[model samples]
Target: MKVTITSIELKGPFKFFALSYRAMHILRQLKATNCLAMKKRGYWIKHYTMTLWKSEQDLKKFAMSGAHLAAMKASKSLAKEIRTITYEADSLPDWPTAEIMLKKAHVIHY
Candidate 1:
């Protein structure tokens, strides 16, 4: 499976609800796709998500279109920082392991 982890730190407390609204849209879209599993955790001003897919191509396909694409574009302003990591995995790991991988993920600047 292709496992991807993403984390976001908001610029202000006010932005969390905005991000949550967008997240809801994306999560709704996710159900119609080929994604295997999805999970999320939040702490303070940060939010994290983990997703499982059949391949990186499948993941990219979802990202490059529709509500997700719009949310990603909007997130640049709503987030103080955003980071993501992608790798192969035989099975989904527990949230603790996923959080560690997210912590080690490279930062992305938009």
Candidate 2:
């Protein structure tokens, strides 16, 4: 299994609001995608998503297309920090493990 984890910190209330609105749509789109498991964490300006996929290609396909792609573009300006990590796993990692992995992941600042 391929696991991907993402973390985002919104710039402010307005950016948060805008992204939250788009997030609703992206969540729905994720649910309909080929991911094996999807989980969301955090609230307010901080948010994280942990997803399990059959392959890296499947995750790339989703990330590069449709709502996910749109969200990525929109977030570049609205987010204060963005980070992600991907690894191969035999099964979905627990929330604690996911969080630790995210903390160790490299971050990008906008």
Candidate 3:
């Protein structure tokens, strides 16, 4: 399985709520094999999402199209920082393991 973990920091409370709503919407509509969303402790504007896919191509197809693409474009200005990590896994990892992997994983900043 291909797993992806993403973290995003929004500019303010309004942006955080707006983006959080959109993220939840996307999670419901996501085509990935498995997905989860969580809020970082002590940070109202910080959020994380983990998703597992059958292949990188499948992940890209979902990310590059529909509501996900629209959200990505819209967040360009609203997000203060964005980081993501993608790697192959034999099975879905628990949330704690996912967090550890994210810390060690090379990040893409935006």
Task: Name the top lDDT candidate.
Answer: 1
Candidate 1 residue 32 C-alpha distance from true site, Å: 0.3
Candidate 2 lDDT, tens digit per residue, 6-26?
889988766777887888988
lDDT string, candidate 3, 51-81, tens digits = 7777788788888877788898888767887
Which pairs of residues have clashing backbones in candidate 2? none
Give candidate 1 misplaced runs (Cα > 4 Å): none
Cα RMSD for candidates in order? 1.4, 1.4, 3.5
How close is every model to the real structure, measured as TM-score?
Answer: 0.91, 0.90, 0.75
Q: Best TM-score goes to which candidate?
A: 1
Better of 1 and 3 by lDDT: 1
Query: Relative to the true structure, how large is the alpha-carbon lDDT of every model?
Result: 0.87, 0.86, 0.70
Candidate 1 lDDT over residue span 3-87, tens digit each: 8889899988889889989988998899999999888888778898888999888999999998899988898888888999989
The C-alpha local distance difference test score for the whole of candidate 3 amounts to 0.70
> After superposition, which runs of candidate 3 have C-alpha atoms over 4 Å from their true positions?
31-43, 104-110
Worst 10 residues of 3 by lDDT: 33-42
* Candidate 2 worst ten-residue window by lDDT: 12-21
Clashes of each: 0, 0, 0
